[model samples]
Target: MIFMTVICTNGFSRPNTDPTASQQRTSILVLNLMPNKQGTEDQIISLFEETNLPIALTFMYPKSHVWRHGDQADLAENYVSLDDISDQYFDGLLVTGAPLEKLDFDDVDFWSEFNAIRDWSQTHTTTQLFTCWSAQAALYTDFRLPKINLEDKIFGVFENQLLGTSLPQWFQIPQSRFSAVDRTDVLNCPAVSILGDNQATGPFILKANNQNTLYVLGHPEYNADTLSTEYYRDLEKHQPVKAPENISLTAPQFAYAHWRCCSRYLYQEWVKQSFLLKENNSHEQKQLQF
Candidate 1:
């Protein structure tokens, strides 16, 4: 039996791929909203490192916002402008979380442009995954769901249970957000179905259109020390911040990547479903041709 390798920056073994299967690659577009674009890219990329499917990722940044997260020269050469891909379609779309959760949706620097991009994703992309602030933004933009600001940040690894479907089963995710949406609000949204929930952090996943649209409230892509780094950064600024739960903060060392297994599993499942939908659509098109 012949096997194919999945390419990823992280040095992990790829799942076996059937040689007879179609080699069509899945195209994924990421809208990076974090302050550190490269870090966000690496976190998201690590999730698919061990997948069996072929994927091509395109990174996009808001043209209206002028913040420097990394070297401008490198960003220009490596990433595509959001405007360039507005009219294009992708198999998967990922919208990363931002640090501006305290600000009103309209107050965001690139709110209008981000709104346009969000609108475009509804029809142009097969599956959309909105994380953290993007998830809150989508809820507000599409369903009028309001986000409640937590007095303290929800920073740490928290356990969550699946609510809707059982494919993902159960998992824990790393969260570092200052705002949260009420489980009741998600329950009230006509277009969304709650997929996962936590007693303390409320709902995590909101699904719509048979999981074609997903609102993930936590950062499943975060590496173990991602939170630790953020915590120390906040400390340096003299901001009052608490240590991440389930991980050591005093040692300031590398923490175990407990979320890695579930993160990879969820991403691979999404890729599998996206390909299945594409295949079904092709079959229907061919049937129409006959």
Candidate 2:
């Protein structure tokens, strides 16, 4: 029942630990590409509520990017300007998704800077997780295989595989995005493993070869009311977002009332796996304590 609380403000964040510590803290840097800066940070933090380990979150805004919709520049609280983060380091990285066109990644203003962090995470951070659009961003940057554009937005509480610890299953995922990533042959990129996929949606979860990096194509961090908020917003804007596919067993608007909770077990499990591979002997001792 122990939870790891993450502190997020305008720019910089470190885990909100109680006191003195001997072990090296696990830090998570979130590349927030949302217009609602503080809200984005809050959604990501919701995921760490059940984690017992220490976690810190830092925000990296794409200062150079053009807005596809709203602007988050005014709402940011703990934002770290690109120049200020040039020498930063962390143990974990969580890339937040944004509503951006996939083909335009190369044209974003801060695209280069985000690429630097992604490249650094490979060797520096113990683990990395890409969410929704961020997963698209990472895949686009890594393999040159672009994220696919969709005819309609895929919005709902998606069912993702909680790939168990054995041969097949890898983890759990929450995917809430308009566009979906195109499925590719796993053999092409052994480094990129497709952990989960939705028959209705696209890739729901993925990870790199080293297993340090994880990606969720949906929004597991979304609160019960998130989908409702989107529904109202789209309706007002007159953007025709159809009712999400799976949830209409009852009334047509029923999915709005049905809320989803984040999968804490999967996150904590991933952390344990990464810690095991990174710090062998120490990891065993930690497990013993657990």
The most accurate candidate by TM-score is 1
Predicted structure with the largest lDDT when compared to the true one: 1
Taking the tens digit of each residue's C-alpha lDDT, what string does model 1 give over 148-226? 9888998887766664465354576788889999888777667777767788788876776333677888887887678
What is the Cα-based TM-score of model 2? Answer: 0.76
Report the C-alpha lDDT of model 2 over 183-247, residue by residue, as the tens digit: 76433776676667666776667666544666677765665556667777888999887755555
Model 2 lDDT on a 0 to 1 scale = 0.60
Cα-based TM-score, every candidate: 0.84, 0.76
After best superposition, candidate 2 residue 211: deviation in angstroms?
5.5
Model 1 residue 110 CA deviation (Å) reads 0.7
